[model samples]
Target: MGSSYQLQQQAIDAEIRSLEGSIRALKLRRNTFAPISSLPNEVIAIIFSFLRARVTLFAIKPGKKPDGLAWLRVAHVCHQWREIALNQPHFWSHVDFTAVSSAGAAEILSRAKTVPLHLEVGAPVGLWDDARFGPFQKELQDRVPHICRLAISAEPFHLHRILKGLIMPAPTLEFLSLASENDHRGGAAFVPDSLFDGSTPRLSSLELWNCDISWMSPLLGSLKHLEIRSPFKWPSLSVWLDALDQMPQLKTLALHRASPVAPWGLIPSEVERAVTLPSLTHFEVSSPARYCGFALAHLILPALTSLCVVAESSRRDYSDVQEILTFVSRHAHGPQDSRPLQSVLVRSNGMGVEIVAWTSPDVHVELSEQISVSDARHSGRVSFSITNSDDWSPRVDTGTLSAVMEALPLDGLVTFTAQNRFNRQFWLWHAPKWPLLRHVRLTPAAERGFREMLMEDNKRRGGPLLPLLKTLVLVDVALLERRNLRLCDALTKRVEQGVPLETLDLRKCLATGHAIELLSKIVVDVLAPEKTYETGSDLVSEAGARLIYVEDEYSEVEDYDEDDADTGSDDEVQDMDGDTSSDIYGEGEAVYW
Candidate 1:
């Protein structure tokens, strides 16, 4: 009986082993018939490339752990995928040193097999002395010759160490980005003069933040896109011109706080002949007004389609502003002169002033948010921004606003959008400047001044202001009884003066039924709520209306009185309008009111 039991146990164990083998064989067979398995190797590699791009983008987000190799997990899905991933040399060529262990780096390098590499290395935060950093530095040193794109962000000391070992030639390199993080803690890191042995023949895009490179470096010769921020030293104006002269093919140039300090008595007349950048289409600069003016005065961008100048000074000087305006006037026309300035957005508040002009008629500009240079570039817009140096100040200097508005080329402007507050007298004086202006969009704070401008224009013996104006959009307004009557009176007067508005769009406005009815009779088309929503009954009281309006008005104004020049009291009944500031700008396309 014991022998029989042993035999049965042995048979059961053998059967179990047999079943496992059969299952393994079935899985292999199943994989063979899978739809993905039928794809060509090249197609599979393409699919992997897409996944790699997406994963790489997410991995680069601030404060996120470096996981450059995370895309390789697809290989672990199955044996077939593993084989495909392993066979593609290009798939292994991108090595982010931070994501790999020393041993893993060696394996990846071996698998890459002489393929040009794209390397990314970021020093670990607060752990620049980590033991693993040594291996990364060594790998970068050994792999410099094969690197095609290298982007590294490190603290100054670590960056110096890594760059010190990269003296070898990088024949295949095309893009290079070196940013020194936490640079404010100490002096900036300087790029070694011997970097790449000055032999990066194919480099086209170069970006450096808190890193300084020689203005005369040979690497500048081939760059098509150049960006430098917070450089350790600003080269002389002549040196900058010489460097730019070497980069004839440069398409995009961004200099943030990187301009040379203007000579004590520097003026536009003192600037030498401008260096012409024939190929440059996008130019952006952020610096003190004087520095920006000095830089622009030295360069001529004939092909420039997008220009963004952010002036960060509060010195009350208009000379720099004049220089910037002159630069804009020179390059205001669109490519090949096919498009001309058609829409203008002007935003002024206590913080500063922003002016955005688009050659395209259909461009919509948001009021409450700042517009970035890149955003303006892609949208074919030109923007000028002046931020108040003192945050506690109630408003930008009145002179600064006047200089910018007076210098604006508004002869052909057809659509005008003004937000926040402007000096009432200033608007009245400049209202007739836009001869071709047809559409006007205003925030509640801006509406009173504009309305008064229209009324003043009607009384003008010469002609009316914004004579071609046809559409009016009032945003975030409160149309109580008195305000309604005033607005209706203004529109009625405009009609009598032969400058009648065609459409009146009230967006996100608190309006009484009677107010909407009165506006409907004046405007050809009045866009407002049909139901009568009383301002003070259960929903909102007169005091409640004041609070609502004041709250929205003060949203952009910090520590400012409600009676400031830009805002009005609630009892006066400011005209009613609706929508967030963004909605007033339209979401997808320009909405002509």
Candidate 2:
């Protein structure tokens, strides 16, 4: 009887617990919830006023389901939430005319008041069907000056409404980006030519992407930056180049070509036009160089400072680098009238055809070993990175380095990298001590540290070992295996005894489960896996440090496409694993290389 009574008591307890949970949930959902007025009105206004572009008609939300007057019910369910949402008029300013019924458009307008409004219409069918968009148009036209920004697709009616209509000049317009095209036979297909003849003066930034234009003239005299991306619709590079030539105040320019044009050489000629801009500082161009038949045989930009060439849908041609050098040498010649460029950058960008910045002359090298580039150009800052996997024969490399060492202003060359051949004889030699190495990069097979016999090898040539090295970049290394320790230990010992190495960049090198252990034994000050987080100290130097882990500085390949369900251009790029690249730079450390 005692055991049975205990069981009965437990059953009663369970029933009581279930009842309490239901009661709590009902309390949270019902009209019993607290009122928004309960909080200070200032707090409520601050919270709701900032939700402009995001909160549209509360009656229709993105990917959310509501059955039968749910919004009104929420207001009626509890008085507080309704009051907070209702009092916030600015929250209802943006009207997304996507799903809202035509009959209710006027009702939404009534709530919007005279405030500046943003209207986004996705379905183009509503353009001419005045029954649907007439009320919304009336609201937008009334507040044209307040419409600081507008994004509309190409359709005859949209063009007529926005362009042809007596559109008041939007003086406050700071940015205008259009991908104008038309499905209607008479839409603004030739609209840019007819409507945009240097008319919009206040527009400071323009991005033309696949925009068809008979005449590419733009009123961008005050424009500071311009981006033109793969205009498959464009006929000639002349229209674009002419537009740029007219813009006297342009500071930065980015050019990207997507398709194969009939006259491929036009773009190369157009790039040469940029040499005319005395104010042009930063220029990045991505195009097919091979099709650009002209070798930049003779040209120079006296004012050019930063240059980035990314080959897009095009392979890198050795001739491109040759052309640039020849042009710079010829046009920027003479010790008296040379414009010294502070930064130079070139990249093939993709894995296809390679860009050869360093070429083996027919004679293997020019024997002049004492080249003074500053006497020739005066601009001391030079940064060059070329990626190509070619057979740089030992003799050719020695000759090339001899030429490079002669040509380069070594002390001024702060950052440099040449990644292709690891077994080149130069790797086996050329200690940076002559220049007192600051930054050095060696490929996978090029092991760090010299063996005893190797020192004797350098001695035979009287080449000094680099002792004051501060930084080293070792990439594409297969150092995870135990056999690799032979090299790792050698590097560690050299750093501790010979070189006062402070920083190491090991980008894209693999790491095993016991990576820290292997590295700890071989390197000084190796941060333990448990202590892998970055310290708050700048120049985090520990005296007598043996070995430490410096994060690799290589690009991490992304294995994107999360759902396998949607890989469209619109879906945000996602990785199966969380973002693999999260290493941030140290706060105040000066990166010398």
Candidate 3:
């Protein structure tokens, strides 16, 4: 009987093996007829374009297999894909000389045939000294005329040699960006006019970082977009006007850290006259805290729709802020310029202070050091931002923020979004009122401040602060029952006082189900009934932008106020337009407000 059992087992094993073989064969046949393999070359070409779009090719290490290049992976997929990719000249147009394999780049160049090339040539840190760049340099010389868009970030010496080697003008070049690999503050290499023999008429957009160019360079004549950064020699105000005058079609101009050669406001009278840019629409300037307003003070942009100014200073400098405010007031109220500013963005991050304010035609005003913008024109809402700055040295004095608020119209403001705790401090200090404010979005830190501000107003019998505020949006804020009971009480008191907060939307909030239930009884509508939801990871808030600090050595946490009873009497609603006094972080500390 044992022998019979062994024989039976052997027979079963043989049957299983036979079945497995048949299954393998079937799978192979099915894969051979797979839908993807049967796709037409035209269809595959479209798929290849989508896959290879925006790919930045880098030089492949000698022995290591290239990993990130999508074209290489596609070519290796199958013979058909390789053939289709190699035959398409446009597919090989964008070449990154820095990371491309010596042999691989040549192959791509050959396949690229007569297609307009977009070349990026740069070597990272240690690779700048490598001998492999010799061949790539020669290839670049051969391909310059065909290059339509070129971006080079290399050692200044290497850049100089490369530009010097261009024996012919790049007739096809339209956009050019040349930047130094090293940080050479005031020692940028001078780009000689003879590099292109004063040719390059098609160039419309030019960006230079840590490089020198003559103000009279022919390249500036037809440029529509010009960006100059950390120029070695600060061009005289008159030189700037002359250069701008040559570019009739210039629309967007940005000058970053380009201070005047002379002291601030000492430009010659001729250069000081405002030069009008008829086609200019967007203007951006960032300069040292002391001279952030230098460029705008010298130019006039009548068609300007968007303006962004960032004043950066390492030490305390109030002059920069004052200059910015003065510049805006002068241009915004000028009678000759009837165009209402569609948007205004001003920020100062220097020393120990940070302040950001953004306003547009549709939205009235936003103020706080933390960045946030709300686009609720359809809903008629405005937003605000706030954040705590550690190492708060009070540099780049924000006294200008209050002045900015006073200069703008805030009566129609409807929505306010607050981000960080310090924003609450800014708000309490400013005590600005928007009679039409109806919706408010708050983080936990700001929530406490909001409650306190509202409770302070509830104490007095005068017109309420934010009387029309009906909706409250809480984002990623936790409510502790023991400590935050007063928050609920404040809402209850405000509701009882007639300015009822109709909706309480708990979004991505960490509140206990019981706490949410309790709050539901107070507010008419409570969102997030589930009491839990993942917070949105979007850094950009509803307001459009928010400023975040990566490193702040000092931060403090305050306990939530749990007291439900109104302990203090209401303070009369102070006029937002008038100067108001309030304690800053300490009893006697004075702030910009």
Best by lDDT: 1
lDDT of each structure? 0.72, 0.40, 0.60
The TM-score of candidate 1 is 0.81
Q: What's the CA error at residue 332 for candidate 1, in Å?
A: 4.5
Expressed as tens digits, the lDDT of each residue in 171-239 for candidate 3 is 888888888667443245667777566678788898887788998888788899998887767778788
Please give me the total number of clashing residue pairs in predicted model 3.
17
- Where is the poorest 10-residue window by lDDT in model 2? 358-367
TM-score of each: 0.81, 0.51, 0.73
| Candidate 2: regions farther than 4 A off | 1-144, 153-168, 180-201, 214-219, 232-242, 258-282, 290-306, 312-318, 325-350, 353-467, 471-485, 489-497, 500-522, 527-593
What would you estimate as the lDDT of candidate 3? 0.60
* Over 4 Å off, model 1: 1-21, 31-37, 54-78, 99-109, 183-185, 314-324, 331-336, 348-351, 369-374, 377-380, 390-394, 457-463, 529-545, 551-593
- What is candidate 1's lDDT per residue for 262-295, written digit by digit as tens? 7765456445467989999888888877787778
Query: What lDDT is obtained when candidate 2 is compared to the true structure?
Result: 0.40
TM for candidate 2 is 0.51
Please state every model's RMSD to the true fold in angstroms.
7.7, 17.4, 10.2
| Error in Å for residue 463 of model 2 | 5.3
Point to the candidate with the largest TM-score: 1
